[model samples]
Target: MPLDRAKTLQDTMTQWRHQLHANPEIAFQEFDTAKFVADQLKSFGIEVQLGLATTGVVGVLSKGEGDCIALRADMDALEITEQNTFAHASKNPGKMHACGHDGHTAMLLGAAKILAESGTFRGTVVFIFQPAEEIEGGAEVMVREGLFEKFPIQEIYGLHNWPSMPAGQMAVGPGAMMAACDTFDIVVKGRGGHAAMPHLVVDPILASAHIVTAVQSLVSRWVSPHDSCVVSITKIQGGDTYNVIPDEVVLKGTARWFSPELGCEIEQALRKIIEGVGKSMGCDIQLIYDARYPPTINTPIEAQVSADVMASLVGETNVNRNPIPSMGAEDFAFMLGKRPGCYGWLGAGQSEDCPKLHNPHYDFNDDLLSLGAAYWVALSEHRLI
Candidate 1:
């Protein structure tokens, strides 16, 4: 195919994207967005299911008897004010599709329309329009609600827009496309005393400074050189007055690693370092660790399937393998963990003028809409056939 039909699909998607971009909704509050998606799916004669994660919608299209494949797109906007001066800029104050989620939803909807019209594939294609991807774990909630069990999907696929890569290009890797994210808070308790009396009391602020320095050694000295990890102490709060030391000091930060085992090891090491340092300094310490998303590991077979489908649509030269893994996390890992699947990066463009993700000035590239739709359609037909 020459992707001619994809151009038509792109035109439809562009309108949908504009409407969505105009009426942006934040995580878990995508009621109108969900309704819009449901209505579109129903209009296309696809079976629709709603309310999996408050406002998530799933559309099912079946052609013949065979296994099923799932295509997912998140439908949540970020808590950012729109800085773009375009006519379709966000109307919702302090909410914008800076992550290109509007584009993702529109492209998936485009694929649904094409697949429903073509009716060339065997089995079913489940279109997942999920909510709350930026904050709460919507993907996690959907899996818990039996999304896969009800749909019985053999494989699932997700895609995100990458602004750094040139438009029309796609990137995929076999494993660890994104890192595991974990957050931590530490409170150090000590006696409060006047700053003038240096020996009178233990300063928790001093102890906290030591702990921060010690924690850095966990990644620098403990973790292997080849393995990737990040430990950043982003916040520290202690004394309010220069003359008096406070009774406690609080520290907040996050840890990231590419492997689950490595993440666990890092957590254990953090606890030991905090407690060991606090005890030695005659201060009590409390640590709170929250494990967020696990690393997104693409199964080999699924990765190959994604690469081949993308190559067929965009040509072999446009698909990239072995792209560097990102330290950031994605909730899509939850779905990929449950099923054999891969998540690929769709290039938006490579202009320095193009706004990066999460930036208020950023908008999903309308030019890539048809390209994404074509990839989705080709993947569905190829996999089902």
Candidate 2:
């Protein structure tokens, strides 16, 4: 029965997925993508509201007043250039859906179509198509602009395609499903001099080097060994010339932690490290730490619901209720902060050759589209009933 139902929508969903994959857009600039989604929803007889958080779309489908559950799918792509040479490859250069958000959107849309046609569910199901999830915090902006106030949704739900896990399985937990994302930028000012000189200048570059090494201790020493966290130095900019020491060196990186308190702890420790280096080097150092996404914590009850529903869809053996949490951050954390929800993972593949998230060759697994859409339908119906 599931196979036949999925087979009916497989072709249409694949076409929609390919279309979205071919024309990838980035955060806050998903005008075309939002339009396409709205049009699709409208064709399915769903009412859509546009202009929330610049390019967000809300599709409302209601039978009778009871409770509302929102299913969200981010429509923004990354700034990566597509490496796959397939026929459905990205048409826009320097932009691709490396995170499988295209698949996510298509899956939700498939559920909307099935529900609209069959009219099987009760109450209301809000389809949230958000923009700028990659960088602009579209969920945060929507909440600030009264998304809940307008929609009055009781519970929200979201999902991401996890390439590390095999397809046809779901992994979730009650606590932190994903970590908080915080970014830091440090600038050190020092005297400039030629490399040939030994003691003529305070080398900002040297101080930055030490600061980088010191900040790593925040995770290894400041945080507990049992805790899950990451402190990575991703970018550094200082000198352009070959032999001349620059006047200032800039260091930038991201800090990730599953514990909410760990975000502030890392920020404080980062400042201390840079300040201590500045004092020791007798130079000026500035630290800027910005709290981005909060920890994506699933409310216990909702998480249990997700686990139960997915188990019914597949089987108890295929569902993981206590999978390890990811250090990666999600903007859905912002939504979960305001309301109760479960942000889950849908396994894409586990093979070593499978492309991972943010990789240039990464692509959404199309085989999971039917299963994902089924899960969305079952989840919304279960919650509403």
Candidate 3:
């Protein structure tokens, strides 16, 4: 019955999603996207609040005196160029909704329209349209701007489209759902000289290579075998000429872990490795490490509530109650930290070869729009009742 109610608006939601996909905006620059969302919420007769985190929008719908809950959806796109040949392909060059944020925004909007019209719940529902989820930490910005302080929201919920799972499936658990993300940069300084006479100068490139190999030990050797951690050197920049070695080599990379204590240990061990390698290679290496998003951990009760509601829509067998956590990071962790909440993954994959998130060829599955919207509505009604 819940899914049927949402299916009635699937066509309208798909149109909204396509419109948003065609005009993709990134980060805090979601001005047009914010206006579109505000216009929709106002048309639905819900109270709209704007200007939080610059482009964030909140739509409140209250029917009676009861608990207040918030459902969030990200609205920003990524910086990757589009590769799809569909009619809804991105119009903006070098910007696309490769991460399914358009689908997320549309689904939440659909749920808002249904809730506003039906008024099936007794309490208040807060619809949060967030921006800059790619890498700018927009959720953190919203929290710092006093999101919870302004609204008496007791619980929050967030959902993201997962490409690895089959369409219409759902996953939620009580522990960490996403890993903490941290970045580091190492600048190795050495003496530059001709490549032909390698003995005459200190090669920072060799030192950088050693640093990379040594940092892998941070996960394999330094961290426990039972625990999970990832250290990747994403960027390496050093020399321009083939005949000479540059004086400095800059290494940029990221570290991921679930526990805060493990995060600290990883950073400390990483700094020590860099310092030792620099000293051994006769180079001066400067390390700059920044801790970004924290692990997304869900409260037990809220996670159970989400799972129960999901089961009601698509049986318990379709729901994954104990799925493994992902290494990818989400800014929604900031909101979960501030309030009791749960973050879930809605499967969006259409086939085994479906393009993954952040890929240029990736597109959100429109068929899942109704299912996701229905899940949101069901959760709202279950919690409010």
Candidate 4:
């Protein structure tokens, strides 16, 4: 197997991942990151292209050209400071690769190097190093700027590191693998007055409190009980002083669902909650709902093929054929919307101490570097065969 040969590149891949982790950049600002990826691709004699989505990079390796397939890796980091005191900890103070994007980038680069050096596959492989996948919509921008139109690709694939699952396990499904992302900003406006005079003020904060509890009912009451969805209020901004009541409360959070109808329903439910509660509390309400990503749904044929390919290396027992889809959203859904593809999860969790994605103490497991590279190589060969 081509992927089996990637074992030799494990150390090299780990070095690359560590370097990327040290210097983290967020969103479309992956200038240094893109250059590094392009340089590595060019060093391997692969064709490199830049500036698709400002800082996105594409590397093409072609042999006899039986078919063309794409493998994507996100290159952006998050806006969190590094807590790990390791040597390769993030150099940037306010930015960190908390979501294992460094690992993702390194693994794909490893696969590219192996494929280029061996020339064992007869098809073309497009390596996509996408910028701004951490909450920003770099994938959507790439699609809008003619990513599929530029490359003659039939099938594309993507993967993310999974800290919740065991390191050797893999998961991919035919239906929704990730949910659609809808972010909302809500403002509850009320009269400001003395804190001690409870009856004198309308109290937007109290109204906001009721709103938080009311929206939770949307999932069980409005949407189907069985559908996978989420309504979370992550941030609340309102009061500045301790003794005075605030005039308004701002609620910021996200809504997630597998289907478009459910996404719409969630938004409608939020509006209803805000309006119904605002009217009863004598407060003005405004909501801004931005649908960022569609659900990452896998076509049946592509999902089956990718799952089978992954099982070849990781074993059938470790492959999760019926794993529950995550409520967290993935922007790769935009890419899949344009092409036939599958997105899988490469398990990186080792023990109970393993931190989940976006956590301050999180780090990409270097052990999965070679395994991920192997999966990419195996996927290309099996799909293009």
Candidate 5:
């Protein structure tokens, strides 16, 4: 039954994906994109609700009587300039759907259409189309705005397109599917003086250099060798003239960790290292750390359900249960925090040798529309049955 429906739905989804790719919108600014999604849901006789997080859209479909399951798709584009030479290339300047969100949105919409038409499920399905996933936490905002309270969902599921995996292959895991992203900034205060006269004033540039090298050792030496952590100093700013020592130096970077305890330990170590170095060098240090989304942890039972559903749809051999976890962060972690759920990766494959997400050359693989839509349908049917 899904095979026949997949064929027809594939064509429709391709068109929808192309339209979205051509007219990409950035985070929190998905006005037209939200309108298109809402209109499509309304046309299919699904109840549509908007204005959850500015441009967020939610569609509800109730069949017989049972639990409510929610499916989510992010609707925001990156700030990258489109480099795809295809006819459906992004028309919005400096904004492109390099993350394959166009495909994600289209696939969920396809599932909605199938559910609306077949009505084979015995429960309700809530389709969430969110915005600002690239910058501000769209899922976080939805939760803050009473998304789950207003529409009571039992389990939530999210899917992201994976470029490295082969087409038609799916990856799912039980815990720590993605990392927690935290950003930090440190400013070292010192007195400016002539470069040739070292004894005249305290130099923060040298102190910052020492701090950078010392911070790198925290993960390698201080933290457990088995644990995974990344501390990278991406930016450093200081003085202007070469002959004069700067009064202060600023350091900016990000930290990623899969374990919550390790994440906390890293932050604590950073503070100690920064302040210790500052005090030793006769300088004052100010540090600010902002925590983003938490690690994406999949419930054990839900992970098994997701993997089983994919295996049933596309053979057991095509479904991978122990795929490697990614260090990148996902806002979907917020939704998973509220309800037991699982997130899986949909293979996008290599198309025109496009670059990865956030790259200017990256574009969603439209050819995988049928497979993605079929996966969504199979997951819904399997869960509800």
Candidate 6:
């Protein structure tokens, strides 16, 4: 029934999703995206608020006096060039909607229209369109800017499209749903010399390589097999000429873990390894580690509420109540940290060869528009009741 109701708006939602995908924006620079969202909310007769987290949009709809809840969707795109030749492929150079935020935005907008017109739910529903969910913590910025203080919201909810899972299936549960992400930069300094003369000069590249290989042991050998932790050295920059050894080498990577204690231990162990490697190789190492998004943990009550709403839309069998958590980080973790809420994953069925999120060839599955919108509507109606 909810799916049927949501189907009526599928055509329009698909168009909106395509438009957003074509004109992708990144992080706090979602001016056009915010305006489009605000205009849609205005058309739905919902009160709109802007500039919360520098382009974040919030739509409020009140029918009666009861509990106020928030349903959120991220609106920012990634900085990846589109490789698809589709009609709606990204027009913005070096930016693309590879993370399916376009569909997330359109679905929530579609839900706002339905909830605004039907008048079936009591109390208020806050439709939050967040920005900068990829790397920057826009949810944290909104909270610091008094998002909850400005609006009388009790609990919040968020959803993300998962291409790895098949369509018509959903995942929600209590406890950690996503890991915390922390970035580290290590600079190795050594003497410069010709590549042919290895013993004649101290080589930073050799030291940096050892540092990289040594840190991997932190996750594999230091941490227990039962615990999940990741230390990856993604970028390595050093020499300009192949014939000469560079004076300095830079290493950048990220660390992910679910528990705070494990996170601390990871940092300590990583620092020790890098420092030890640098000392052994006679190189000066400078390490810079920044704690980014926290682990996204769902509260039990709201998790059950989300699961029940999802089951109502699809079925008990379609809803995965105990799915394994992901290593991928979400800024929604910031919001869940502040309020009791649950963040869920919506399956976007694609072929096995299809690219996943952040890939240049990846695109949001448009078929999921109706189901996602219906889920949001059902969630609002259920939670507000």
Top TM-score prediction, candidate number = 3
User: How much is 187 displaced in model 4, in angstroms?
Assistant: 0.9
Please, what are the lDDT tens digits per residue for candidate 6 over residues 45-133? 99999999899999999998899999999999998989999999999999999999999999999999999988478899999999999
lDDT of 2 at 177: 93
TM-scores of the candidates are 0.97, 0.97, 0.99, 0.96, 0.97, 0.97
Better of 4 and 6 by lDDT: 6
What overall lDDT, based on C-alpha atoms, would model 1 receive against the true structure?
A: 0.91
| Position 343, candidate 5: lDDT | 92
lDDT of 1 by residue, 136-202 (tens): 8799999999998888899999999999888888999899898888889998999989999969998
lDDT winner: 3
Candidate 5 least-lDDT 10 residues:
347-356
User: Lowest lDDT 10-mer window, candidate 4?
Assistant: 1-10
TM-score of 5: 0.97
Query: Over the stretch 114-147, how does candidate 3's per-residue lDDT look in tens digits?
Result: 9999859988999999999988999999999999
lDDT score for residue 187 of model 1: 89
Residue pairs with backbone atoms closer than 3 Å in model 5 (clashes): none
lDDT by residue for model 5 (1-385), tens? 6646877988889999999999999888999999999999999999999999999999999998888899999999998888789899999999899999999999989989988998578898999999988758899999999999999799999999998887788999999898888899999999999999989989999999999999988888888989888898999999998799999999999998988888878888999998899889999999999898888999999999999888877789999998889988999999999999999998777754757778888878877787777777888888887
Superposed on all Cα atoms, the candidates' RMSDs to the truth, in angstroms, are 1.4, 1.3, 0.9, 1.5, 1.4, 1.3
Instruction: List where candidate 3 sits over 4 angstroms from the true fold.
Output: none
Query: Residue 251 lDDT in model 4?
Result: 94
Query: Per-residue lDDT of 217-254 in model 2, one digit per residue for the tens?
Result: 88889998878889999999999888999899988899
Give each model's whole-structure lDDT.
0.91, 0.89, 0.95, 0.91, 0.89, 0.93
- Of candidates 5 and 3, the better by TM-score: 3
Residue runs of model 2 more than 4 Å from their true location after superposition = 1-4
- Candidate 4 or 2, higher lDDT: 4
Q: Regarding TM-score, does 1 or 3 come out ahead?
A: 3
